[model samples]
Target chain A: MKRIEKVADMAKTSRILAAEGKSIGFVPTMGYLHDGHLALVREAGKENDVVIMSIFVNPAQFGPGEDFESYPRDLERDAALAEKAGVDILFHPSPEEMYPEESDIRILPGRQADVLCGASRPGHFDGVLKVLTKLFHLTRPERAYFGQKDAQQLAIIETFVRNYNFPLEIRRVATVREEDGLAKSSRNVRLTPEERKEAPAIYAALKDGARMLRESGDPELVLGMVRNSLGRIPDAEADYAEILDYPSLRPLSAESGEAIIAAAVRFSGARLIDNILVPLEGKTS
Target chain B: MKRIEKVADMAKTSRILAAEGKSIGFVPTMGYLHDGHLALVREAGKENDVVIMSIFVNPAQFGPGEDFESYPRDLERDAALAEKAGVDILFHPSPEEMYPEESDIRILPGRQADVLCGASRPGHFDGVLKVLTKLFHLTRPERAYFGQKDAQQLAIIETFVRNYNFPLEIRRVATVREEDGLAKSSRNVRLTPEERKEAPAIYAALKDGARMLRESGDPELVLGMVRNSLGRIPDAEADYAEILDYPSLRPLSAESGEAIIAAAVRFSGARLIDNILVPLEGKTS
Candidate 1:
């Protein structure tokens, strides 16, 4: 349960761990720890000799109009939760520490980044990739843990690791949700009471679409139904609703191996996104 | 010397080397194996327990009209030279091995990469930085060496390592030269017989500019003298001849610590460049 700030300090600590033949498992987060983040920490604790969780609410990832200033941060609470989850180290660096100098270098995705979240928030994934790259270099983890809640992010990270030939393994944890089917997110606290009431509709739409896709072999029809369901929610503005191939984020023609029914909707000025994978119906082991 | 082509092989080798507590020294070169590259290898061999050299004629660094296809390469000769220089490994990866998938991630330098060779070759430094970044990640060298002949390239790599917080040390090997003062380069093989005869003028002009700056501390006056000196060579066409800050490469005005007389000249359709640093006269040790 040690806390560190400087990049050099963290790198030195990680190097010692690596020198001792200990495999490091890392979970990079933007603080405001929820069960989802804790899930990743727990997974890392199980898999590696040492687990590190970095809390950096990276300014690079937020778009100009996005809620960067209002992004939730609770370092003390996060540290306690991470310690409970058996994290060995908490890397909590300030923005100035994380980005000592402005970077013009960016990591952009191929066709995958041009659609969905990328289109909605330009330069967002580039920022994400940039911080992830820096953290990866600093940590040099044997395995890195990421939650499936950020499914597209996980996919892009996997692509980045493969494409860059990064010497690390990536482990994706399942999306942690609340009893109300709401995905655990720091931004969830920003939702107004009315917005909170309507927020679950986004997830409901995804669930409905995935169930329909599993029952019927029509992707377009299921997507349309999800759109219509989201459209009917009070003040809920659907950014996009599509059933896409797992990981690639490419739009799928029909229900293939494991298709993702993903959607982003704006409710009371807060953009909420959710997704559920529709498992292949007749492929039980 | 052991030669590895695949990134996986290099990573495996690096892991074993790390386990043995051996420091890896890396020299990344576009093979034509001249004295300049060997100088770097010699430096690496002296400083590190394990010396690794990569001979990749990166296609990404060449512009549309540049000599990418004709970039001289002789792996057998390079392997022998590396072995002679006591290199432990020579990584000779194919373009496919390095770039298995097309790269959309570009490492754009903020201030350093947009001038000189960068201006002449768009997306050139992005390619250079990307490939070098990949190499750094794969090799995880204790220190990496680059010749000061490509001053701009050296500056870019320095800035990258600092900004990205890469753990490797950077060593700038002094520029190696031919007997006639021509900077040693693989591209020197591409020069026609007449071009070869006139290539010395590039260095001559640089030396003249350095002499002028040392004798008289006026950058403008030094530049004029160098320009006129290059103008004397009948076959040589001056591209840019200016006195600037040694490391930053910004145009100089007042007396500075170390100033460079950097110039690029086109001789017989082959662009040649050279620079010499002049410590300000009367500066105390």
Candidate 2:
């Protein structure tokens, strides 16, 4: 795979590809690639003549006292994974190259970013939207792949593309997981062995909530049962757990037809978040 | 010349031209086709294989009490003028097409937008930046043209392009004028007959400021004299008459090398603004 660094170089290469009438698919990520990232790449590689991936540990997405400086980065391994996944170009730009000057203009996604992760970490989605827009413009890709693990981000990006009339298709891929049902995340590497054992508890709680909704058909009862069960896991602190509308990420009522069982837990200082989409009466895609 | 009323159709045409290895130049305007706009179109047409002009009186750029609804628009006349100026395509999207939903994403240029026109109308530059970004992405032009009459706007757009890494060149064309020396603008239609007669005072003030700087070589004396002269016009109120550094748009001192005299005035409920760039003793271009 070809590795590019400068934004100018990437734009020039994409210009030539566009001139040749070739379609490009893009997958943007922070380093330390996992199964979820690989799944996005495979989906992008299947639909376009060229597949491009970007690995940027964006500082704007992290808040104060967050993991901005100590975020895990393994370029050698990440590049190998991307190449095996059929990526044609891997863009690895340094912080200086990506943000040469201070940015005064920020892209805010109205009410869409006013809840969920946006509510918890202020200005986080603003950073994501900025970098995503820059990458999208630089690559001019025909399609972009995003995983369901970041469902809120995917929804905000969808609003961005529609509101700005961006000429690209956004494909949402299913969330990938480990054999033990723990959602794959680079942050999972930071968990201690004991915390790792309890990390699966978060996913288990989500599954329990989903299963209860499918069986009892009461979202409130399912949420209360999962909340009570998650509190019993020793050394695990539940940050937030609730039933929300699938893609909208809004709090769902007990009478809602479809909902997502989402939860965030703090285990050994590493925050783990997971969710499962389940229908109250019918199946949710 | 081909005329497209829908953004989607224009984008399709732009995409086809890009695929054919043609360089596209863009000129975005708010219709009514003044000499200044024609000058920009001619300049863009000369340098590009295909030239596209968009006439959108973006509502977001106007304040709640500003003249968004009364903004002058004549698509038929604008199309003829664009065609005469050798424009290849004219993109005229309606309000609904441009903004299907309310966009909360505001592109505010903090310090750069907090002066001059921005001072009088809050949130004005944010709207300009947002719409300009959308237009830039939709056209994907190799070069975009803007009249230097709106000097601060040109400066903000330059910074936006650099900070965002937009792979497009920005060309600043000289301000076009009428025989009476008043700068060409659609807002000129808002001036009463008597107010129209005195409208040239805005340009006169800029020229007077430029001449004083050239003769006395004292930035303070030049700015004071211009402010005094503009204060003399009847029914014309001077908003601000300051000399600032070129490109940066910051207030310049007597020791500064390069400066630009920018001013804004209001007469008969019509706000008028203009600027003139002066190369200092040591500065060139």
Candidate 3:
């Protein structure tokens, strides 16, 4: 796979590929690849002539006192994994290369960012939008692949892409998980021996919460039940447990036929997030 | 020129042209076409295989009491002028078409949007950035054109495009003017007969401010001098007059290599703005 670092070089390569009538599928990620990222890459490869993946641990996305400083990175392992996954180009840009100067423009999001993971991580998705804007313009993909694991992010991006009439398609891939039902994530590697064993409970609580909410029709009770389940994990703090309208990420209502049961839990070293989509009684996607 | 009023149609046309390896040069305007807009269209025609002009009087860019409601628009005349200037396509989308839903995303600008015209019109550049972001994505031109009459806007756009690494070149077309030095603008139509006669003084004051600032080395005194000149017009009110570091839109300092002398004058029904760029003692562009 061809490796690129400079911003202009990536844009140039994409333009040349476009002129040659090659369809590019872009998958942007903060590196330290796992099965989840590879899932996006493989899906992109299946649909397009070329798949381009970006690996940059954006400092802007982490809130203050958050994990920006010690975010795990493994470029060598990531490059190898990306190549094996049929990625035609690996864009590995440093912090300096991606953000040469302080960004003055902010892509502030609205209600879609008010619930679930957004509550604790203020300005996190703003940074995500900023980097994605840069990456989208640089890569100029025909179709961009995003996993349902970052479901809120996927929804916000999909909304903006449609609202702004961005000249590309957003392809959603299902969340990749381990045999134990733990979601595959780069941060999973940061789990200690004991926390690693307990991680499966996070996904289990999400499933149980969705099943419970559909039956009880009481969101707050389901939220408390989900938080109670997550809090049982020793040495782990439950960050947030929420029931929001799916894709819209707003407070749920009866007419809203689709909803998401989402939660975040913080281990000593890593803060992991997970969610499940559940159908309501009335309307469904 | 072919006329397109739909968003998807414009995107499709641009994409088809791009697939044919045709470089598109874009000139985004607010209709009620004048010589200044034509200059941009003419310049676009000279550079690329396709010249696409958009006449969108974007409501997002107007403040609460601004001229958004009364903004001049003449689609029939604009189409005739655009075709004569060699425009291949004219994109004219309605406000509803452009913003079908309320925008939750805001492109908040930084210090670049805090002074001069921005001071009077708060959150103006945020709207400008929002609409331009949409246009830039939908049109996907190789190079976009902006007139230097709106010097602060030109500078802000240049900075953001560079900072964000937008995949297009920004061509700076010099401000087109009347024989009497009045800047050509759609708002000029709102000027009363007497106000029209007095409009030339705006540009004249801008010229004098730059010269006096160079000689006096006092921004405040130079600003007052320009405001005083503008205030002389019968039934006219000087909105703002100042001299500041060019492009950055910050207070001027000795080390700064370039500065701008800018002013606005309100005459009953119309508000006119003008500026002149001056070379300082050091660093040349």
Candidate 4:
């Protein structure tokens, strides 16, 4: 696989491929590739003539107290995994290369960004949108792959693309998980031994909440069950457990068409989040 | 020239051209074409394989009391002028067509937007940037053209394109003017006969300011001369007359290498703005 380290070279390469009528599928990621990231690359390879995976741990997306400095990265290991997963190109750019100067323009995400993860982490989605805007323009992919594990991010990206009229499709792959139902995440390794063992409850609570959403009509009841499920865990502290309408991320009413049961739990040193989409009575995905 | 009225059709047409390796040059304007608009179209025609002129009186750019409702528009006249100027396509989308819903994402322009015309028309640059973002994505131009008559807008756009890493060049066309030296503007027609007679003084003041900048190094002195020059016009009310550094639009200093003299003056019912770029000792444009 060809590895590109410069923005200009990547843009030129993508332009040449575009001129030749080749559809490019891109999977943008921060390094330390896992099965979840590889799953996106595999899906991209199946759909497009060229598949590119970018590894840049963007500092813009991290707040002051966030683990930007300690974010896991292993370039050589990621390169090997990406190559084995059938990635045609690997774009690895240094922070200096990606951002030569501070950005003058700042993107403010809409109302959807004011709740859940957005409420706790201010300017997070704005940074995500900013980096994605740069990456999208640089790569100009025909389709971009994103894992559903970051569902709020996925929804915001979809809205941004639709609102901005970016000529690309956002293909969402399902969240890859472990045998114990815990969602696979880069932060998983940061968990202490005890925290790691108890982290599965985060996803378990989300699953139970999804079932409650499907069977019951009351949003508050569903949320209470979710909070109670997380409360049962020995050392788990619920950060936010709520049921909101999908995509819009607005408060869910009894008549709300579709919903997402999402929760974030704090355990010792690690913070874990999980979500499940529940289609309403007659709806099917 | 082919006229497109729908956003989807324009995007599809542009995509087909892109796939055929054709470079598109775009000129985005609020309708009621003048010599200034035609000059941009002409320049775009010279540089690109396909030239597209989009006439959209973007409501997003106008404040509540602004002339958005009374903004001059003559589709038939514009279409004729565009065809005579060798435009390959004319995209005339309705306000509803451009913005089906209130935008979820609103672009906040940087520091450059807080002065000059931006001070009088709040949120104007934000609206301009927002519409341009949408149009740039939909049209996917190789280069976009803008006249220097709106120098502040041009400066902000240049900074925005640079900051966001947009994949296109901004080709600036010299401000086209009437024989008597009044910069051509669609708003010029709104001036009363007496107001129109005094309007050329705006440009005359800018020219004098440019000369003062070349001869003297003091920005405050140059601005005082510019304001006095406009002050001489019978019914003119000088809105703002200042000298600032080029591109950055920051306050100018003796050490500042290049500069721009910009002013906005209200004459009866019309508001007219003009500017001149001054290159330092060894620099030439």
Candidate 5:
């Protein structure tokens, strides 16, 4: 595997590979790689001739008082894991290299960014869109991979690509999870042993809530049930729990074809989020 | 020239040509086939293997009370002229095709858009950025061409591409003009015979102001002279006349490297604009 730190060199390398008719699958992550990130890379490796993974702990996506300073980063460890995960190119750019100059321009998110984690974290997805815009322009991949773990981000980015008519595909990989149903995340390591034991409840609640939503087709009832289920965890504060139309992230209606059961829980040391996409029993997704 | 009206077809055609190692030069314009539009196509033809010209009277760029309702469009005539200018592909998409769904997402401009024409037409460059985002994605050309006639738009777009790290290049084509020095514009056709006779003064004022700016190194003095020159035309109104730092479109200072002298004039039925890019004498541009 090859490692690149310069922005211009990565862009040139990707363009050269593209000119040679090689399909590139790009996976953009915020370093401190875990099984979730490697899962995306492995999927990219299976689908394209070259898999390019970018590790950028983008500061733009972090709001004031957010975990920007505490974000985990280990380049040496990440590089070794990425090589083992079949990544062909590793793009690790510093903050200065990614944002050389300050300009007021921004890629604002649409309606899809208003729900789930976005409700509590304002301007978060805008930062995500900004970084993706730069990364996509540099990579110019045939297909870009995203794990369902950050489902709101995946949906917003998919909408951006579709609305902007970007000539590439968004391939979504399923969220990697532990055998006990806890979502694989870099923050998972920060959980105390007791918090780790209770973390599995988040995914279990989503699973049960999706089933309830499919049967009742009532957003309010399913959401309340999810909140009640999350309330069972000791000292685990539910940041947000809601049901909305799948990718649009709008209010659910009778005509809605699909929905998402998503929740974010704040523990002592880390915050965890999980979601499940549900196709209505009688409606097409 | 091959004409494509559907958005998907144009994107696919461009991508196929790109995959074949063809460097595309894209020229986007609102069509009435003036020499100015053809000049951009001619420049695109010379620079790449395939020249793609899009004739879209983008409503996104026109604000309320603007000329969107009466903007000139002549597809058959434009197609003939584009072919004569050696354009390989001509893309003409309707407003509905371009914006199929309502999306609030926008690519907002920076300080570069807050001056000159943007001052009078609020949210104009936001629309410009929106459409250009879609157009640039669909037609991922090696280099995109713009006329210096709309110096503010060119500067804002150049900044957008640079700040976003878009892989494509921005090539500035010199403003195409008539023998009497009137900048070529579709709106010029609306000018009465008498108005036509006096229109050359717009460019004349810009040329004189550029020299004044260089000699005096004072923006206010040069802009006052431009306004005074435009005031000489009987029954005409000076919409705007100003000089500012080039590209960045910021306030001028002792450290400024280059500048632009731009003006817009309103006739009885038509509005015209022109500009001159001036490199400050002891500075590297």
Candidate 6:
């Protein structure tokens, strides 16, 4: 597998691929690959002639108090896993290489980014959109793969592509999970042994909430059940448990067509997030 | 020449061109054609296998009270002029087609857009950047052309492409002017006969200002000369006459490397803008 470190070199490679009419499928990620990231790469491999994976722990996406400095990264391990997963190219660029100077332009995400995780962490989606813009331009992939684990992010990116008329498709793979149903995340490594034990409850809460949302039409009752599920786990604090319309992430009404039950919980040293998309009556995808 | 009125058709055409390994040079403009717009198309024709010109008078770039409603458009004339200039395709999308819904995402231009014309027309460059982002992605040109007449717009776009690593070159064609030295602009039609006669003073002021800047290193003196030159014209109200550093558009000092003398003048019925770039003692491009 070819490894590229410079943006210019990446663009050159993509152009050469374009000339040969090779369909590139890109998987952009921060290093410390988990099954979730590998799942994206695997899907990309199945769908395209070439698979390109980018591992850059983008600093712009992290806030000043966030884990920008301490984000997990292991290039050697990530490279081996990516190669095993059939990635043709691994783009690992330095922070300076990705952003040589402060950006004079930024992507301002719309109202969809104002709820759930966005409320807790402001400007996070903006950073995600910005970096993705750069990566999409550099890679020029026929299709880009993103995990449904970051559901809001996937929605925002999907909206950005549609709104800007980007000539590419965004393929969303289901979230990869541990046997216990906990969504796989790079931040999962930061969980202490006790915190790890409690992490599964976050997903359990989301699942129960989804079930409640399907059964009962009352959003408040569903939210209460979700909060109660998280409350049962000692030291697990619910950050947010929201029943919002899918994709748009707006507050869900009884008549809302489709819904997503999403939750974020704080477990001592780590923050975990999970969600389930609930198909409304007579509607399924 | 093929005329496309839909974004989907335009994207398909660009993709077909890409598959055939044909280089596309794009010229994006408002519908009212002038020599300046033709010059960009002419340059694009010379440099690529296909030249695509898009005539879109973007509403997003105009303020509420601005001339968006009154923005002059002559599609028949523009189409004829573009065909004569060797344009391969003319994309004329309606505002509703360009923006089916209010954009959920937008590009917020940075400090470079906060001065000169930007100060008077808030969110102007933001709108420009947003439309260009959509157009650039849809057209997927190997090279895009812009006139140096809108120097700040050209500079901001160059920075946008650079920052995003867009896989295309931005070719800045020199400003095309009439024999009387007035820069060719679609807005030039709004000028009365008497106002049109005095419109050349805007360029004259810039030229005289550039000469003054080259002779004397003092920015204040150069700016005064420009303002005074514009003041001598009857019914001409100087909107802004300032000497600022080029590209950065910051306050100029003796140590500033490259500089621009930009001015906006308001006539009885029309507003005109012009600028001149001056390379300092040890710098030349």
RMSD of each: 2.6, 2.2, 1.4, 1.7, 1.5, 1.4
A84-171 in candidate 5: lDDT tens per residue? 9999999999999999999789888967877778889999998999999999999988899999999899999999999888889999
Each prediction's number of clashing residue pairs? 0, 0, 0, 0, 0, 0
lDDT tens digits by residue: candidate 4, A93-123: 9998889886668888989898889988899
Q: For every model shown, what is its TM-score relative to the native structure?
A: 0.94, 0.95, 0.98, 0.97, 0.97, 0.98
Q: Considering only N, C-alpha and C atoms within 3 Å, which residue pairs clash in candidate 6?
A: none
Instruction: In model 2, state the lDDT of residue A65.
Output: 88
lDDT (tens digit, per residue) of candidate 3 on A246-285: 8888788877878898888999889999999988887844
Task: State the DockQ of every prediction.
Answer: 0.52, 0.64, 0.75, 0.72, 0.78, 0.80
Q: What would the DockQ be for model 4?
A: 0.72
* Residue pairs of candidate 2 with colliding backbone atoms: none
Query: Which residue runs does candidate 5 get wrong by more than 4 Å?
Result: none
State in Å the error of residue B42, model 4: 1.6
**Sequence-dependent TM-score of model 3:** 0.98
Q: What would the per-residue lDDT of candidate 3 be over residues B200-268, giving only the tens digit for each residue?
A: 988888888888877877788888888888888887898888788887888887677888888888888
Question: Could you give the DockQ of candidate 3?
Answer: 0.75
Show pairs that collide, candidate 5.
none
- Candidate 6 lands at a TM-score of 0.98
Candidate 4 accuracy as lDDT: 0.88
Model 4 / residue A36 / CA error / Å: 1.3
For residue B55, give model 2's deviation from the true position in Å: 0.9
**Chain B TM-score of predicted candidate 4 relative to the true chain B:** 0.96
Best prediction by DockQ: 6
On the 0 to 100 scale, the lDDT of residue A253 in model 5 is 74
Please list the residue runs of candidate 6 whose C-alpha ends up more than 4 Å from where it truly belongs after superposition.
A282-285
Per-residue lDDT tens digits for candidate 6, residues B43-146, read 99899999999999999999898888887988999999999999999999999889998766888889888889989889999999989989998888999999
